[model samples]
Target chain A: MDRLLVVRCPDLLDEDEDGTALRSFVEVVDAVEAYCPWITAVRPGLCSLPARGPARYFGGEDALIRSIVGATSDITPVEVGVADGLFAAVLAARRGLVVPPGGTPDFLAPLPVGILGNPGLAELLARLGIRTLGDFAALPASHVLGRFGADGVTCHRVAGGRSGELAELRQPLARRRVDEQRGGGRPGGAPRRATVVDEPGFWGGVGDTDVRAGRSLAAVQDLLGPDGVVTARLQGGRGPAQRARFVTWNAREPQEDSTLGAPWPGQIPPPAPVVVHPTPLRAELVDARGEPVRVSGRCLLATAPGRLSVEEAPWAEVTAWAGPWPSDERWWSRSRRKSARMQAVAGAEAYLLLVERGRWWVEATYG
Target chain B: MFVASPDRRDVDAPPPGPSPRRSLDRERDLASLAVLAERTRPVSSSQTRLLPVVPPLADLLPDGGLRRGSTVVVTGLAGGGPEGSGGGISVALALLAAASGTGSWCALVGLPGLGAVAAHDLGIDLARSAVVPRPGAAWAEVTAVLIEGVDLVMLCPPFPPRPAMARRLVARARERRSVLVVVPGRAGWPEHPDLHLGVSDMRWDGAGTGEGYLSGRRMTVTATGRRSAARPRHRHLWLPSATGAVAEDATGTGTAG
Candidate 1:
């Protein structure tokens, strides 16, 4: 998950028929973008950017947040906060507090379940005596999935602080409104090539396959809606999921300086995993004594890993393993995390596993 | 500064006039240029119409490249579990690398959480590839549509495709002159492909009991197909060598039968 800094203007959240609030929100985005180039307009009045780079540039997160607040205060009263994921970051912005790294779960535990934005689920949980996120997080995942379906499982993960995002947090249509304000012609800019007026077989012209592909992909959009088809663009980040961003195939534009050539200090070496779970899978690692293995505060393993099970599947012997690469990210900021990653080869498969808060999760697979 | 340099330059220079022309006329020159352009096009030859394959995996195909209208099935474990699993996704991705790099468009259907970095490491042109991670119940229809648009389409059916559906897709690929690469993970393909590649015996070379990082992996790839490639051929390869490109595993000898 990304360590994000969210800027929220409470008064500008709702749009007026006269378009007054949206115009002010655009000003807020422009002011924030002056400090950081990667600021994303999550919605009409909310925006976020990865906190690591900007924090490093302007002394620290506190200084950076202060500078942004100072810049945007003229346009609209702005609140800024940094946290691990977008959902927590938004909540942090609301309270004007920075949630410390590896502290999101603790931060979310005391909040009411209604904060999840799903009133129906909250009302149901309220009846079941699960009023707070902490109580909801305590339910066994299997029971949650059986009762709530996939959406429930997702909410369960977010409430437990194991995951950082919820599908309802951002409205894509609102983001498009912000994009249109930035003068990129139409919302997503033009398609990469001029597929409409194609001059096939001529130099510098679109090919026959490209035109055919555009038409077919448009057909898919008709079948599965606009968000169905996507293309991946490479970006610099530590985790596999963070390194790439998937955008609607038609709306994708060439982003500059998104190559892997940029130096990322703590990234895992090459031969990157072929599968990065969008949501990390739960795992249990135990020693021969059947005792759960742990990583100490000093970054040392409690015992040699003997067996491992993912999603409560049958245990497989841990044949070979690598470092518990300590990731002390954003240490300068209050949102610092003390997680570690390891490469474990069990049987015929290899997995990039992450351990945080004494819980293990399968982050990626080298298949 | 020096005025005599003009005469000195003339000693080594040819008289300026109309540029020399070839003895061949304009019509002949145009014909020769046309032949050069046709031969230099990315396709192997006009008759066979083959797409290029990476050098390490060339021998796995009967035509030394992907035939324009052929179906290839790649089988391996699908998901990760406590029991360990190796997906045939890497091989399927490797097949797309060479063709897409040479300006061919490709599409991936029904594979989720694609490790984009790994695809880039294997030399795939991400700009030219379209990925439909979750096609749901419409995976077959999605694959059929992609076959008409892209030069190569890699399909991992989200469900066990019915025999009729699989046959229809295979027939569609044949008719459209597209290369269909299927990574039939758990949802097996019912129709027989022109070429079948299976991945097995995966072993990691580095990282033993909290030691070095993952440097490389050795795996056995068996290729069997119809007609010219009726006999099975086994080859050992580093699916992802230390730098993340396919390479021949020198330690083991391949057996062809």
Candidate 2:
């Protein structure tokens, strides 16, 4: 008997966040190995490594499968199937076989047409009302080849338990979960399994809320592919709605754009809605005065660094400089400051400033 | 000077022939002759020189390349001879074509009558070029502006300039690296130019009895001031010949005629 262990992962997409789901699957494989000390050999995925050695080491087909299934139950919920060939083993596993041996053909006979890799073949078979693998196997190979080409002949062979190929298993380095014991063991010296406890205590120091707007800026950067631009408007405070605008350039894609209020400890600002667009050559930024501010950086820095500014705070580094013109205030209001403004192009946006008291101060930045 | 005839009887009869009108007419003729002499005074070779159309011809000139931006004083004779020829339009076109082809923008100031369209007909694309017209004697201002940013400037002074002013403008042109082609009307230009071209005997291309439809009259081009190792060669160019004109033994040296 060939004891074939088929492990199926129910959720693949959830693994993208981190390797949690894959780690869970690895734990189950470790348990099986622990129980069956005489299990001969173990393989990871069936499609990757040669199965000949394991098949021969277990002595015969029937005994190998029984030993594998018996050990597997100690670990996780897995269906064990055994067969003479690779296709038979896989089909038997999918049919929910607990202990299948020499029943490979019967196991595969009534399986759906979808099991074959080719959808066109499955559709054609379904249209002909050939609901079982037996019906496909019954067709003459030459006639099927004449109608559907060489793939049809291969499918016909697979439908029967006569596929000459063995399962190719890809073996990964044996990973023992923290809770599982390692194989090839001397019992007394076994390492203690480390369990990852997902408790609130695990996340103790790391705050739950992101108080600074850096998180939002990071999101926006991701959405804009490399060489993108962003223009933003920031408005806050209780008094007559102060507004600031800024433009940033050369942003990377899949970014998140958000805004947060001043970074006060223990207070997290809600992330503003992110707006994304294809990359632009330049962007603009503004402040409550609707003027642009300049941003400067060291040229040696290859990537764009994120920027955040406080309302009414002055920025000293000037990247670009413009003006010495006096604004006419009598045309508008006597209270307005008739000063010279400088425009600065900064990372992710532009900053504006008004020169006063022999010092430069930020007026606006592109949002 | 009196031409006394051997027959003295006629002397006494003519001695009585002193009509006031004739004397007056003679005085008027002498005054007119003095005026004509002043108008047609031949400028000394040292006073001004005509440069050649191209720089390579500068070596062929006594002075290098029309004094490098000095005014070229062209003098036209009342009739006949090299000075009598009128090819200012052709000369202007050729100079412009050569300068602009070498990536220099030329400005023609003050001569609005110098049709850019005619320049186009002569193979100069003036559209990509500029022409500014100023009234009165603003050649100095125009010349200053041309030398500032432009590569070549053709300034037609409202009134004939003094010899010193012309020399100064030429010097300025050199400093500015501009080619200043001053029309002959300006006075007191430099004599030594890179190239001096004298044109004469211009005739219509197709006229008179000709053996073929395209046959044209021949013209004479003389190179008198060329200083290059190559001896200045003059040629008679048939305007409508299949090969146009031949010069310097079959080399076609003076085709611009």
Please, what are the lDDT tens digits per residue for candidate 2 over residues B23-59? Answer: 7666665565555555544353211222233443233
Q: What is the TM-score of each candidate against the true structure?
A: 0.60, 0.27
- Our model 2 lands, by Cα RMSD against the true structure, at 39.8
- DockQ score of candidate 2? 0.00
CA deviation > 4 Å runs, candidate 1 = A1-206, A251-257, A329-337, B1-48, B77-85, B254-257
Tens digit per residue, CA lDDT, model 2, A43-77? 33221112335546777544555665565455444
What lDDT does candidate 1 reach at residue B116? Answer: 86
Candidate 1 lDDT, tens digit per residue, A1-367?
A: 6789999999999989988898899889878888877777777789888899999999999999999999988888988989988889999999999988889989999999999998989998999999989999999765774466445656787888766656577655566666566664445543323212223432232354565666556545545666788888899888777788888887224422246688898889889888887778898988889998899988789899998888887787899999898976532226656888889987567889888878888888887
Sort candidate 2 into its docking category. Answer: incorrect
lDDT of each: 0.78, 0.40
